[model samples]
Target: MTGLRKSPRRLRIGSERGSASVEVAVIAPALIALLGLMIAFGRVTDADAAVDAAAHAAARAASLERDATGAQARARAAAEDSLHGDGVTCQSTDVVVDTSSYMLDVGQAATVTATISCTARLSDIALPGLPGAKTLTATFTSPIDTYRGRQ
Candidate 1:
């Protein structure tokens, strides 16, 4: 019995030492990249919503105007104000108002269309392979008062 005494199973402490650190080192970059991607996606989504709202506002503003020139100017201002109020900072912003409806005679059904384009900056995210900026565009149409006079 003494001669057959079982040898104790040896635990290899050194083999597992620093393993957690190694694992973290290997996985940290991937986790960081994933988080960055999520942030980028969120930013893009928010910008899209902002642009859409801007277009809607612009179209509504334009539809309320009685003349083509006034409609264009009001639409641009409304779009810009909407985007700014939404905290969307764009590298370049373009607002196009189609006011052909204003030429329609009074009591005729017509609509105004507004298109807004914003170049949102993504470089702040600092994600590799991500575009420095993305252009978000939205278009909206609003019906003008059928009984209202138009020029």
Candidate 2:
């Protein structure tokens, strides 16, 4: 006698065949888009850090000057130099220096502020209604020595 009666056969892989490939095909575009976004974000973050460093260098350079005219020139040059050294190429770069503190009376606390704006080109990251470039701005302030003689 047979130990057990025969049971109805069930097919486990009949309908689900190639489902993994289908799922991957459906999700491939989304995954690619996510990766692209991450790469773009990383580039923007690096540019932001470079711009901040440029601003800081500009502020420091301007703070060492004794006159507003020299400070402005130095700040602009320093900002450009720093950005270039950091391998950040900007399509358009602007440097602004606030020299109001330079006019303060001697022995008073003085501060110089430098603001840098940079528009960097993106790598084929074009979207509808979105520009292919990103503008990053940074501002830094540095204290001028109170004991230093002013012009």
Candidate 3:
């Protein structure tokens, strides 16, 4: 008994052997969640940027020749290039060009919509718990009438 009492520190240390795991269990999830959210948000922002770039490109193209198909195509290419140059898929089969305003109108902006998905990986344990991945869509509008070209 005396020896055991003398080694009280050792016993205390031994009791907490799995305590690291406990601490990790409590904290790891929150950390993982934060990280996942950040990654997801990053992808969302990137997608938005791509859409904006696509819209800008399309509007510029439309302003030149009033060709809706070409404008949409340019926008899609630009957006795809934004995402590692993998090529973007336009959300709609038809690239709607609101030529109603024409170049003479104050607001001759056209809308382009695209969807992009990104894969984010986490710890193996967290993978099943977290959403596998998310597909994000973004719409961009640019004013064709306001386009001056070559600033």
Candidate 4:
């Protein structure tokens, strides 16, 4: 009767020694860059969503106004407030409201369009060839009350 003996598996350390180190050295920077890119895109996406919300709020505010001048003012204020409330700090923010439909006669379909444009600062994200800021824009339209009278 012979006893079974277990042998250890040999590791080929001659050619593969330090291979993992080399791989890390080669891939670390690329992985880091990819992470940075994803973060930048996420920031842009957040800013885009914020802009869209601001535009919708502005349009709705404008549509509820009685006069074009007041509508424009309300739209601008609503957009700025919405962006700020959402924590979207923009380097520059612009709100453009089209209140031409206010001139339409009563019982006619009227619409208010609001465009929100914002240049969001991206200093936190460090990536080559990527700008320090990105501009996000959104437009929304809201209808005025059909039976509302115009002054």
Please report the candidate that would top TM-score against the real structure.
1
lDDT by residue (tens digit), candidate 4, 21-124: 99999999999999999999888999999999999999999999999999999999999999999999999999999999999999999999999999998887
Candidate 1, poorest ten consecutive residues by summed lDDT: 6-15
lDDT of 2 by residue, 30-146 (tens): 887777787778788999999999999999999999989999999999999999999998989999999998888889999999999999887576533335899999999999999
Model 3 residue pairs with clashes = none
> Per-model C-alpha lDDT, please?
0.94, 0.89, 0.49, 0.92
Instruction: Name the regions of candidate 1 deviating beyond 4 angstroms.
Output: 1-10
Off by over 4 Å in 4: 1-11
**All candidates' TM-scores?**
0.92, 0.81, 0.53, 0.87
Off by over 4 Å in 2: 1-15, 127-131
| Residue 6 C-alpha lDDT in model 2 | 46
On TM-score, who's better, 3 or 4?
A: 4
| TM-score of structure candidate 2 | 0.81
> How does model 3 score by TM-score?
0.53
What are the RMSDs of all candidates, in order?
2.7, 3.8, 6.5, 4.3
Instruction: Please report the candidate that would top lDDT against the real structure.
Output: 1
